[model samples]
Target: MTNQGFPRGLRILTAGEYRHVFEHASFRIHGKGLLALATPNDLGHVRVGLVFSKKNVRRAVDRNRLKRLTRESVRLRQQWLPSVDIVVLSRKGVHEIDSETLARQLHGMWRRLEKDVKRQPEHQQ
Candidate 1:
């Protein structure tokens, strides 16, 4: 059986890594309660970072729930994503939404990001 866990390589762990995407975002995918900013990477695979501030999520448990859901969504769909670094930002009131709705929103954003990348092949190096 293949490993089905979130690996460290698929994560943007350092502050500089997150800043790289924030400073040079190639695509911005917007959802109801979330925003994903992406910048190209040469790693030939997708990497993701999630931002769920206390001001936005308000509760530790809610932040963890959102982070878990986001990570699962990314891990499952990583194969379909472009070679880029993505930072997912949570908006205020995001914790109020149900898991299904949040998942759906994330799915749409991923699809949108794929389409946007395809549309701008020149963006990729």
Candidate 2:
């Protein structure tokens, strides 16, 4: 079994990584101001990346809050995720939602993606 612990390895760190997910995403979900895009990886553990644009939130404090919320949620649930690279993008109005609501929406998106990825054919990967 793969290491379920989320260390540095379980993260999309490079520009190319972000590009790969964007170019070859097999699963995608949009929720409120958040958009999650994912593609299967050969690695045995899931990895995630986040993108919060200033144009969307228009405030550094709100953008940081979104990132913090996202990382916390992903960190808690990452062990159950499939081997995939995921990128999260924020749109306008993300900061308006409360953290609990934001979390609920994010979790729902993850659940949908989990099901979608499982149903995809190997060729899609």
Candidate 3:
């Protein structure tokens, strides 16, 4: 099978999109310096957004690295994820962790979110 790229439709773009997921999150997980917020979407596919503030990562290089790792983690697990909009927020001390550790945290977070999404009522989720 051919692999399609991570297009705009598969991403939570724009401030409004981010705000919606943040304000109306149906599930959340806090692991290490990662805070994952998820809300069901009508698009019938999983979309992810990354939030790496200067206060958290300090350096632009670090922020970009975290973002890349987070994206890779999400992409690898998207097939099993529920149709939801997810936003991963980086907190203080996130810059200290390496990509492998960060990826592990993200994996755990996604598993937690999958459980939460499945537990929700048919109408709500």
Q: lDDT score, residue 38, model 2?
A: 92
True-vs-predicted CA distance for residue 31, candidate 3, Å = 0.8
Least accurate stretch of 10 residues (summed lDDT) in model 2?
A: 1-10
Alpha-carbon local distance difference test for all models: 0.91, 0.87, 0.88
Runs of candidate 3 exceeding 4 Å displacement: 2-4
lDDT for 92 in candidate 1 is 82
User: Where is the poorest 10-residue window by lDDT in model 3?
Assistant: 1-10
Q: Which residue pairs in candidate 3 have backbone atoms (N, alpha carbon, C) closer than 3 angstroms, thus clashing?
A: none
Number of clashes recorded per candidate: 0, 0, 0
Residue 94 of candidate 2: its Cα lDDT?
87
Whose lDDT is higher: candidate 2's or candidate 3's? 3
Candidate 1 lDDT over residue span 1-125, tens digit each: 44566899999999999999999998999888888999989999999999999988889999999999999999989888899999999998899999999999889999999999989868354
For 70-113, candidate 2 gives per-residue lDDT tens digits of 87777788877778999999988889999999999989988988
In Å, residue 28's CA in model 1 sits off its true spot by 0.6
Give the runs in model 2 whose Cα sits over 4 Å from its true position. Answer: 1-5
Error of 2 at 97 (Å): 0.7
lDDT of 3 by residue, 34-112 (tens): 8988899988889999999998788999999999998888787878889999999998999999888988888999899
TM-scores, all candidates, are 0.94, 0.92, 0.94
